[model samples]
Target chain A: MHQSRLTRWFFQNVGLASALLLFAVLFLSYNMMHPRGFSAAVAVQNANETAAIAFLAMAQTLPVLLGGLDLSVGAVMTLTNCIASELVNGSPAQILFGIVVTLLSGAAFGLMNGLIVVYGRIQPIIATLATGAIAIGLALLVRPKPGGDVDGDLGWALTNSVWDFADTYGIAGGGDAWWIRPFADIPVPVIIVLLVTILVWVPFRRSVTGRTVYAIGSAEGAAFMSGLPIERAKIAAFTLGGFFAACGGLYLAIQTSSGNADIQQAGAYTLNSIAAVVLGGTSLLGGVGTAVGSLIGAGILRVISFYFRILDIDPLLQPLIEGVVLLVAVSFGAIRTLRVKNKLDLFR
Target chain B: MRISVSNENKPILIASLFIVVILLAGTVYTLSTAGTAPLLSPKYLLQQLQTGSFLGICAAGMMMVILLGHIDLSIPWTLTAAAMTATAVGGEMALPTALAVGIAVGMLNGFGVAFLRIPSMIFTLGVDTVLRGLMVAQTGGFAPQDTATPLMLFLAKDRLLGIPVALFVWAAVSVFIIVMLTRTGFGRSIYATGSREGAAYLSGIRTRFVTMGAFVVSGLCASIAGVLLAGYSAKAYQGMGNAFLLPAIAAVVLGGTHILGGRGRYIGTLIGVILIVLLNSVLSIMQMPEAGRQIIYGTVIIAMLLVYGRNQRVTS
Candidate 1:
C-alpha cells in the first residue's frame, strides 16, 4: 500500500523535484563559470525570470488542466505588453493602471476562449488557438514596433532596490558595487512571484474552487454530473491564466526596459511554461499541478538556459534540448496516464 | 437515384466561395488603382502570383496533414531540412534522388506518428527542431550556395508553352492527391481514422498505419515544396523555410480542413493557399509594413475560421 502510494506521489510530484534539481545544477554551474559572481544577485535574477515564466505557465496550465492547450500564450504576452505601453504611457500612475488593464485584457481574452470552447463545441486546442491569434492581431494593431519606454524612474523604482545593501547592483557587503553592477540587486518580479504563490496559489488550489479545477480536469463530464460549474471553472482557469501571462509580459517589459514585439519571441516561455508545469508534476492532461511546482519548473528552465550560457553551447542547441525535455516530460506523463487508466479499467 | 450533395462537394462549395470573394476583392482593388496602371495587368498579377507561388506549393503538403486531423508543425523545419538536403545534392544529382530523400523524411514523420503513437504536434515539432539543428550544423548557419541543374532552373523559371512549368507540377500533384483522397482506399482510411479512430480500428482498419501514412504524405508534400522553393530561388538557405510555417497551416485551416484532423479536402487547402498568396500580394502592393502584414494575416485567418465554423455546423 505504501509503495503504491509512493508511486502515485512520484507521478504526481516529480516535476517539483526536477525543478529543484535544475535549480541546484544551474546555481552551481553559473558559479563555476563566474567564480567571483555574487550568489545572492544570481538568485535574485533567477527569481525574477522564474516569476515571469511561472505566471505564464500557470496561465497556460489552467486550460491544460481542463485538457486544453493554448498556443497563443506568446501572442498574448506580446499583445499585452504592446497595449500596456500604449495605455500606461510613461507615468507611474499609468504603470498601476496598466497592470489592471493588462489583467482585464487577459480576462477578456480568456472569457472569449472559454465561451467558444463550451458553446461552439470546438476542441479547446482549436478554439484557444483562434482566440490567441485574435489577441495577437489586436496587440499588433496597438504596437507595430518594439518601441515604448516605461517610466524610467518607475521602472527603476520597481526593478531597482529595497534596502540599502540591495540596490540594482549586488548586495552592499559583497565587494565594491562596481564589479556587481551588471547583476543588479533584489528584483521586484521575484517578490511578486512569491506573493502570488502565497495569495493566489496557496488558498486557491487548496480551496473548493481549486478542487473544482482538478475535478474538471480529471473528468469534465463527471465533474458536470457532480454539480460543478464546469463552464465557469474553465473560464476562471483561462482568465486567471491570461492574467498571469499578462503579468509575465509586464515583468518582461521591466526586464528589457522597453517594448518590442520581438522581445521573448524566442517561443521559450510557451514551451517552457508547459514543460515547467509538467515538470512540476502537473499532469499534462490537466487537473493536477501546484504553483510551487510550476515555480520550481520555471527556475529549472532558467537554470538550464544559464548552464547553456555557461557552457557556451550554441543557442540553437537550447531548442534541441528543450525538444528532448518536452518529449521526455510528455512521455512520462503519457505513461503515467496509461497506467492509471489501465488500473481503473481492471476495477471495471 | 436521387443524387444528394455528396460529402466531397462541401469542400468544393467552400473553395468556390473563397475564390470568388478573393477574386472580387482583387478586382475591386485593381479597379480602384486602374488610373495609375492597368487594374489587372497580366505582368503585375503574374509577378504577385509568382511571389506567393512558393507558399502555395508548401500549403499543398501542409493541407494533407490537416485533412488527416494531424499537423506538421515542423513544416518550417522540414522545409529547412529539405532545402539543406537539396542544396547539398546540388545540380549534378538527378531530381529523382533529391525527391526520394524528401519522401523518405516524410515517411519518417509518418512512422513517428503512426507507429510510435506519439502526438503529431509534439512529434513533428521535435523533428522540426532536430532537422533545424542538423541544417544549421551542415550549412554552418548560412544559406548554402548551390547551383541548380539546368532542369531545375527551367522548371522554376521557364514557362511551358506560355504556362509556367511549376504550374504543371502544382496541377499534377494536386490531381494526384485529390484522386488519392477521393478514389483510393487509403484516402477513405485517412478520413475514417481522423474523424473516429476507435470506430475505424474496430472496423478492422489499421488506424495506426493510416495515421503514419498521412504523416508520410505530409512529409512528401513538404519535401516537394522544398524542391520547388530551391529550384525557384536557385539555392536553399538555413532558414529558407521559416516563413512557410504559419501560412502553410493557415492555408490548410482556411481551406476549411478542420485543424483537429479529419473531414477536409485538398481543394480547400489549394484555394486557401491561393487566397492567402493573393491577399499578401495585394497588401504588399499597398506598401504595408511587414509587422502590419503579420497582424492582418493573423486576423484574416481567424476571421475565416469563424466564418467557416458557422458554415460547418450549418452544413454538417
Candidate 2:
C-alpha cells in the first residue's frame, strides 16, 4: 500500500520530474557542445540569463496559485530596471537607496493591481492588462532610450564568481589549476537563486497565508465561506509577485549593466513566464504547483533555446517551436478534462 | 434567460451619446486652438470613418468570440498571416486565399478549445506565436515585394458616391453580424453557451459547434481587416497587424460587452470603434508621444471596465 501511494505521488508530480530531467539533459548537452567545457565564467553567464526569467516565472506562480494572473509583472520588471538604471549609480549608499526605491515601486504597482481587481471588480486579466500598459508607459518615460548605467561594483559582485580562487591562491590565469576549479565554478547568480528559494519560497510555502492562497485558487467560494481572509491573501500574493518581478528586473540590470524600456522584451517575458509556469506543472486554473517547479520550468525554456543554437536550427523557428512545446505541455494538463462526467464541468 | 431588447439597447444608447459628446468636445477644442474644426469637417470625418471601419470589422468578430466567453488573441497574427499570404499570392486569387487561411486557423483554434479542451487564451496565443514565426520565415525579415491587388485597393481605398467603399463594406459586414446575433438561432446559442455552457449543452445547443462557428467568424473578420489594411498600405509588412489586437479588444470591452461573455451589443461595439478611432485621431493631432498615447489608451479601457464592471457586480 505504501509503495502504491509513493507511485501515485510520483505520477502526480510527473510534470516537475520530467522538467528536471529535461533540464539536466539539456544542460549536459549544452556543456558538451560548448567550447569552454563547463567553466565557471560560462556557467555564470548562462545562470545570469536564466535567473531573470526564472524570477519572473516565480513571480507569476504566486498569483496563479491565487487563481489570478498578473500580466503587469513583466512591465513591473521593466519599470524597475529603468528605475535601477537611473538611480543605481555613483556611491554604494546611493545604489542601495536606488535598489530599495525600485523594489518599493514594484510593490506599489502590485498593490495598485490588487486594489483594482478586488475593489474595482474588474477581472484580473483585464486589470493587469491595463496596468501593464501604464507600467510600460512609465518605463518609457523613465528611460526614453536604452542608455542608463547601473553601479559597476554591484553589477560585478552579482554577476561574477563568488571567489576568484585562482587569483586568491596566487596561481597565474589560464592554467589547468585543478585545486581551485570547483571554487571558481560557483556563480554568484546561482547562489542568489538558491538563497531566494530557501529564504523566501520555502517558508512562504508552509505559512498560513500561502495555504490560504492555494485554498482561494482551488475554490474561492469555499475559502471565503470558511473565513479564509481572501482579500488579504490575494493582496499579499500580488504584492510578493511584484517584489519578485522587481528582483528579476534588478538581475536584468546587473546582467546587462544597463537599462532598456523595450515593450517587446517586456511582452516576451510576460508570455514566456506564463509558458514557464505551465511547463512547471502549475495549473493555469490555479491551486497547484511549487516555486521549484517554476525554476525548473524556466531552466527548461532557456535550455531549449540553447539547445536549438547548438543544433544549428534557424533562429526564426524558435518561437514556432516554443509555441508547439507550450501547446503540448498545456494539453497534457487538459487531459483530465476528458474524464469529466458532465460536459458543463468542462467550461469550469 | 434572454435579455429584453430594451435592456440590451440601453448601453448602446449611452455609448452613442458619449461618442457624440466626445466628438463635440474634441471639435470645440480644435476650433478654439486653430480657428477651424478639421475633425468635424465632413471630409475628415468620412476619412476617419474609413479607418474606423477596419477596427469595426475586427471588433465585430471579437464580439462574437467574447460573447462566447472566449478570446482570440491570435487575431493579430492570423490577420498578418492572411495578409501576407494574400499579398504574396497576389492578383485575383488574393482575397479568397487570404480569407481561407483565416478560416483554417480559426477552425483549428475552435477545435482545440472545443474538442481538445485547451484553454482558449493559451491555445490561441500559441497559435499566434506559431503564425508569427511562419510569417517571419516566409518574409525573411523584410517587407514582401508583392503589392495589394487592384480589387483590394478598390475595396479599401476607393470611394462610392461621396463615401468610402470601405465604409460600405463595413456597413454590410456589421449588418450581417447584427442579424446573426439577433435574428438567428445560432446567435442565441452563442449567448447561451457563453452564459452557461453546461446548460446550453443540455438544451441541445451543440456548444462545441457554436464555439467553433464564433471563432471561424472572428477569423474571417480579422482576415478581412488584414486584406483591407494591406490594400490601404499597398503592401503587407511584418508586424503590420500588431497594432490592432489591443484596440480591437478595447473597443469591444468599451462597448460594455461583458469580458466574461454572455451580454453585449453590436451597436455598442460600433460606437466603441468610432470613439477609439476619433480618440486616436485627436491624440495624434495633439502630437502626444507614443508612450503617452499607450497610457491614455490603457487608462480609458480601465475606466470603462470599472464603470461597466461595477454595474455587473451590483446586479449579480
Candidate 3:
C-alpha cells in the first residue's frame, strides 16, 4: 500500500496499457493490410461492427468489478436488440420511444438479476444464467422470425463516417473543416464509446456507489464491516451494467439495420464479452480493472476477426484461429501463478 | 459426530419429492386432455430415462467438478470432438479414440485450471472454442458425413431386460462414480478442496491433483455422452453438444450439489435429470411453444434454487 507513486501507477494501469497497446498493434496491422488501407469508411465499418461486443464487455465489467458475474448481459442484449428492431422504425417519435423502451427493458431485466442475486441469495452466476434464459425466451417471443428493422435514417447516421454525419447535420466538422480534419473520419461508434465513457463510466467510477462496489469485490465481509451499502451498490452495478448491455443491443440494431434473437449470437456475445473483460485485465475474482481496458480488449478481439480476413486465411479456419488466439491471449494471465512455491498461495 | 446425517440426505429427498410432483402434475394434465396416463406409463418412463442417460453421464462428471466448485464449460465441444473422432476413425479403434479424445481434453482442461491457475470457467470456455475450431477445421466448416459404427449404436440403442442400453451405461457410470466418491481418498479431497482450497492444501491434500482429476472425470463423462449421443443420432454434428451443456449443469445443481461445491449426491443428480426430462415432456404434452418451454424451464430452476439454495442470505 505504501509503494512509490510511479510504481503504483505502472502496476495499476498495466492492464489498460497492454490492452491499448494490443489494440493499437493489431488494428495498425489490420489497417495496413487492408486494400482500402486507412480509409474512413473502413474505420467506421470496423467500429460499427465492434460496437456491440464493446458495449457488452462494458456491461460485463461492472458485475465482475462487484465480485459477481452477470451471465444475462448477452440475453439482455438480444432482448433489447429485438425490442429496438420492432420499435426503432417508423416516425421519429416512434423510434425515440422504441429506443427508450428497449433500453429500459434491459434495465428492468438487469434489476431482476440484481434482485435475485442480492435478495434471493442465489449465486450471481447461476441466478443470471436462469434469468438470461428467460430473457432469451422473451427475445424469441418478440422476434420469432427476425425481420424487424431500425429506422433507415438513424441507422445510416450512426453507421456512417463521422465526416459524412457532420456534413449531413451541417455540423462544423463537414468537408474542409480544418479544425476537425484529423477527427473527420472518426467513426460514430468511436464517438459513442467516448460519450459512454465520459457520461456513464467516469461518473460511476468517481461516485460513492462505484467505490463501494470495488470494496465489496475485493473483500465483501470487510466491506460489510465498514458499513458500506453493499446491497444497493450491487444493485446499482447490475442496473448500470444492464443499461450498457441495452446500448450494445441498440448498437447492434443500428449496425445491422435490423435485429436477430438468435441463441447462438447471444451465447457468443456473452462469452466474448467475458473474454474481453478477462483480457482487459479485470480479475474474474473481482475488484480489479477498468471498463476502458475492457473496451480496448473488445476492440482487440474484433480486430482479430478482421485480421483473419485481411490475411486471407481460409474462411473455415477463422473460428479456429480466433479460438487459438483467445486461448493464447488469456493464457498470459496464468503466468503469475507459475512463480508461487507454496501450494496454499494458489488459493489467493 | 454421532448425530444422524439428515442434512446430508436432504438433496436426494428434495429431488425425489420433485420427481413425484412433476409426475403427478404431468399425469393430471395428460389425463384431462389426452385421457391417457402417458406420464405414468412404463414405456414413457423408460423413454425419459433413456433420453436422460446422456445428461446423467454429463452430470456425473459435472458433479465431480461442481463438487470442487468448478465447472467444465467444454462439455459441448468435448462431446462433439469425441463423436467426430470416433466416427472419423470408424470401427475397432472408434471407442478408444473417442474416450481418448475426452481424456486428452479433460487433461488439458485440468492442466490449465490446476497448474496455470486460470479460473476453470474461462479456461474451459477457451478450450471449448478451440475444440470447436478444430472440429470445424476437420470437417472443412460443413457438417460431417461420417456415420456411427455398429458397436456404438449397440451401446447407445440396444436393450436387455426390457431396459434401454443407455440406461445400463448410465447405471454403470453412476455405480463407478458412487463407489469412487464413497470409497476413495480422492473423492474426499474433492469435498475438502471445494470447501476451502487453502485449508485443503494446508491439510496436506494435493488440491491441484484433485482439481485436475475432477476435470478429467468431467471430460471422460462428456466423451461418453458424446459417443452415446452419436450412436443415438446415428452421426455426430457441430452444435449437437450445445443442447447438453446448460441442461447438464442444471441437473447437477438441481440435484442439490451445492453449485459453489462440497456437498451433493449422485442419486440426487439422477433424480434431477429425470425431473428435467419429465418437465420437458410435460411442457410438450401441454403444447407449450419452444419459447414458453424455455421460460418455464428457467423459472423452475430459479424457483427450486430459491427454495433450497437461499441459505447465503444478503443484508443479514
Better of 2 and 3 by TM-score: 3
Off by over 4 Å in 1: A1-8, A11-38, A48-51, A86-91, A119-122, A157-187, A202-216, A263-294, A312-348, B1-12, B36-49, B94-101, B288-296, B310-316
lDDT of 1 by residue, A252-290 (tens): 776666666652372545756766666666665567677
Docking band of candidate 1: acceptable
Per candidate, the number of residue pairs that clash is: 11, 0, 0
lDDT string for model 1 (B188-217, tens) is: 988887777777777888877787777776
CAPRI grade of model 3:
medium
Compose the digit string of candidate 3's lDDT tens values, residues A165-186.
7777677845558887887788
Model 2, span B225-308: residue lDDT tens: 999999999989988887787778878877878788899888889988998898888888778887897788778778766655
What are the candidates' interface root-mean-square deviations?
5.9, 2.7, 1.7
Which is better, 1 or 3, measured by TM-score? 3
Shift in Å, residue B15, candidate 1: 4.6
Q: Residues A1-348, candidate 2, lDDT per residue (tens digit)? A: 999997898798887777777778879989999878588777877887899999999999998887777888899999999988898888868888988998889888888887887788787877888889899989989998998898766776778776642343345463246665666668878888889888988888888888989998888888888877777788878888888899899889978888899987898899888878878878778898887899989988887776675677888777678777767767776677767887677877
- Summarize candidate 3's per-residue lDDT along B1-316 as a digit string, tens digits: 6755476576668767888998899898888887889888898889888988998899899999999988899999999999999999998999999999999999999999888998888899999999999999899877789999999999899888989999999999999999889889988999999999889998999999999999999999999999999999999988889988888888988888888788888888888888888888888888998778878889999998887777554432
